[model samples]
Target: MKTGIIGAMHEEILLLKKDIQRLKTEQFGSREFHSGTIDGKEVVMALSGWGKVAAASTATTLINHYQVDQLVFIGLAGSIQAQLHIGDIVVANQLIQHDVDLSRLEHFPEVKSPFWKDFSFKVLPQSEDKALQAVETFLANLKKGDYPAISKEYAPQVHLGAIGTGDQFIASKDGKMRINERFPQILCTEMEGAAIAQVGADYQIPCTVIRVISDKADEQAHDAFAEFLFENISNISVEIAKLIL
Candidate 1:
């Protein structure tokens, strides 16, 4: 089966693009898709850009055009939880849009969305149990000898929980705290995961996101991003994909 891989930033998918064999490029609406095979699994890789619109648009194309059986996204996120540190992995069990306020629209859908845009029409998106299990399997056998970062006694942890997405970047302690209050289960915040999850849901495709924490989402967020934005955290996503495939 073909799998579509998307990353919000160039660095997120660069290594995977380099690893693809028999690559072919195709463009639609200015977005380019790199289609090929990753260790024998048919794959399509693309930069979905930042925010909800870009991610949703890219996801629609991948599902409709490539006929992919599943979708996977990997990108960087800022930590909302104090316990989370740089280089930690967050495997999304569910995704919601922290910025979408639909309290007023409750009568519209008559159902409920952890985010906006749904109730009667749609609901939040989630990774399949098997998807989480596959990722956990990969993590279980991981060795610190190869991944020196995790080799340390206080190595970063691989957490699985809800991920919150919004178009706006969270860079203040207050903003981070507010979201934490709203979505008490949120592990990380980023720009695109929820949108992709929604699109996958609309098309009945399974979706999964693997995020690496690169910042604290605090006043120092700007500095933290500048320091680690291009450090290729997307490698974690690719490794997870390789194991699952």
Candidate 2:
């Protein structure tokens, strides 16, 4: 099966690009698409840029142009749940767009919104199962000696839950509270996961999102995300991909 891998930022996919063998690169809508095999598994990789529109566009292009069978997204997120801290992994079983509330416009009578009923998109059950198992295998055999020194500080724990996506980077406690109040089940927040998941649903393609916690979604979130991005976090994606691919 051919898999299309997307990352929210260049750093999120940097190591992945290097791992692809016999890579063929091309430009689509000004974004580079790398087609190759990762450990003999057919794959295509691309940076999905930063927000809903960019991610959805990239996802649609990957589905229509590359004709990839399954999609896997790897990125960083801000933790909404107090128990979740930096380096923790979240495998999204479902995704929703927190920024898409249209209930206020219900009085328009002609306004149709998916959020009015149910906005969450479930990851394909079969693909979600495979991803969860892969994460388990990755975690079970992980050794500090096998990774960077920074990894020694915390052993990453996997959490399977719903993730909220929006164009805004949640940097305040009040913003976090408002989201949690509406989507009480959201484990983390990011800029692109749900948009890509929606595209997958539209195209009938299986999609899986894996996020590593980089911030607490609080006042200091910006600094946290920046620091975590420069660390050895990308290695986590590489190890998980090996098991999944």
Which residues of candidate 2, in runs, are more than 4 Å off? 108-117, 148-150
Query: RMSD of candidate 2 to the true fold?
Result: 1.9
TM-score of 1: 0.85
Error of 2 at 121 (Å): 0.5
Give candidate 2's TM-score: 0.94
In candidate 1, which residue pairs clash? Answer: 111-119
lDDT of 1 by residue, 1-245 (tens): 89898988876776678888999999999899999997888999889888999999999999999999888888789999988898777888788888877677667765655643541112224345555666666566555344443333424577878889999899999999999998888988999988988888878888888788889999999888767665435555566667656
Best by TM-score: 2
Q: What is the C-alpha lDDT of each candidate?
A: 0.79, 0.88
Off by over 4 Å in 1: 107-144, 147-154, 232-234
C-alpha positional error of residue 16 in candidate 2 after TM-score superposition, expressed in Å: 0.9
Worst 10 residues of 1 by lDDT: 118-127
Backbone clash total for model 1 is: 1
